[model samples]
Target: MVKCCSAIGCASRCLPNSKLKGLTFHVFPTDENIKKKWVLAMKRLDVNAAGIWEPKKGDVLCSRHFKKTDFDRSTPNIKLKPGVIPSIFESPYQFQEHSYSVMDSPKKLKHKLDHVISELEDTKESLQNVLDREKHFQKSLRKTIRELKEECLISEDTARRLDVFCWECCQESTE
Candidate 1:
């Protein structure tokens, strides 16, 4: 299964064929202290409960949340600098728990505000639809690549036939 960025409001995932090839995911730290810091930066919590969100072992954060300097270029594989925390975030669903219409009783202002909020919700839904489509595309692409890889391998008999076919082509070209 493809790992997605654990950061709230981030939709980046590990799709090798995706346009977001630059997107890299880092596993949550094993150390308790560093892990806590990472979780704190995430600003996520169990909605039904009080405690902060604790990531499972497979959970990861995408590179977009980190600064360019956070990566260690000296290493062949991209790696995070020690103790770096993800700071970048976009809260698509992080609206206030209560609407201002409750407190600010001006009906005219409230109507305009509600209209804007409605548009925001529609935009958020559209974004979610796009992400879902991308996920489907990734799954389909992976399946196609796997099938192509499987089809490319020739049995010994097929390989011998291919060699003969190539030789015939070469003779035809020469003639």
Candidate 2:
């Protein structure tokens, strides 16, 4: 019997490929066109669920196959696809779990929106207060202008000073 390593193209049989005795395995392509050639080359190996033989080297197989050498028999555990089970919302247990996650989401969003609205309301109130103060200041300014004009009528120098002050006030207001 020609001895071969489990890996691709070393030709040196440095170690035993199979962990157990008498059972040999190899991986081969499952495609129908290539299956016959693979089966013919690796004679004693059977295809597993994945169509892989235990000791596959690249795409080809060595003549010697991996065989069961130990008394302990181990089989691969198969897993089902996630989609095979119903959607999370379908089962009551799943629905509750999903609902809990969704429930947590909107609460934070609602809180943030509420906080933003409160901030906006506070800003609006502050702006209105500022506008009210400005209106009162303007009314007091008009009264000061009437008093200045009355003082200007009493003296020409006072009239010149009042004219200068009025022009400065008008320029500042435009700015």
Backbone clashes in each candidate structure, one number apiece? 0, 15
Model 2 lDDT per residue over 1-175, tens place? 5444443322434236443433233335455555554444333233355454443444433323322231134455222222121111112234345533346667777987899999999999998887677667666765676677776644656656765676676557546
For model 1, how many clashes? 0
In candidate 1, which residue ranges exceed 4 Å CA deviation? 18-20, 91-94, 97-175
- Model 2 residue runs over 4 Å out of place are 1-104, 153-175
lDDT against the true structure, each candidate: 0.76, 0.47
User: What TM value does model 2 have?
Assistant: 0.31
**Residue range with the least summed lDDT across 10 consecutive positions in model 1:** 92-101
Highest lDDT: which candidate?
Answer: 1
lDDT of 1 at 79: 93
Candidate 2 has its poorest 10 consecutive residues by lDDT at: 81-90
lDDT of 2 at 160: 60
